[model samples]
Target: MDKYDVVVIGGGPGGYVAAIRAAQLGGKVCVIEKGHLGGTCLNRGCIPSKAIITSMKLLSLIKSSSSFGIDVQGYQINFPKVISRKDEVVLKLRQGIGGLFKAKKIDLKNGDYSNRFRAA
Candidate 1:
């Protein structure tokens, strides 16, 4: 069994940051993540929401561009494209975190680490 100076339970923002710090401090750090690397915020919450919101904001601006003396003839919202863009954004960010872990020499393990404490 491999051993580590620090084992982070999740790969969320806080957990990943802590693990990276531990590695930077010259400790063997391992992060056990059940889901995607960036956790809820990056995968489903903040990042994804922002992607969709940004598209919507752009659409709104285009619809009102006449006020700005810009001739905007047509505009359409492609739901699939919006979702795909969100997924792409999330994947890029998640990969970035993974890269950081590799560069920092932090071990990343998927799924739960189920070894409970045992009294010797």
Candidate 2:
């Protein structure tokens, strides 16, 4: 079994950032992420919310375009399209962060674990 200098339990912003810093300092690091890379921030929480907010802002701008003296009408917000775009943005950012982790040579493990230590 290979022992790492550091083992991080989460892949959230804090954990992943710590792992990267440790690796930069020449320490062998491994990150255990039961969920997707970038953790909640980049996976299901912050990034998703930000993307949705972006869509909302865009929709608002379109709806209020006439206020800016731009002649526009029949503007509609496609909820499904907005959601799809948000998912794409989140996925792209997640993959980019994952690539960064890989470039830093941080071992990323994805799976659920319990309190079980088997004897070899």
Candidate 2, residue 33: the lDDT equals: 81
Each prediction's TM-score versus the true structure = 0.94, 0.88
Per-residue lDDT over 1-120 for candidate 2, one digit per residue giving the tens place of the 0 to 100 score: 657888888888899889999999999998888888787778788889999998898878888888899867787778999889889998898888788888989888778654533344
Could you tell me the C-alpha RMSD of candidate 2 in Å? Answer: 2.4
lDDT of 2 at 6: 88
lDDT per model vs. reference: 0.92, 0.83
Writing each residue's lDDT as its tens digit, candidate 1 over 1-120 gives 788889899999999999999999999999999888998999989999999999999999999899999988857889999999999999999999999999999999998667753443
Clashes of each: 0, 0
* Superposed Cα deviation of residue 60, candidate 1 (Å): 0.1
CA error at residue 57 for candidate 2, angstroms: 1.4
Q: What is the C-alpha RMSD of each candidate to the true structure, in Å?
A: 1.5, 2.4
Question: How well does candidate 1 score on lDDT at residue 48?
Answer: 96
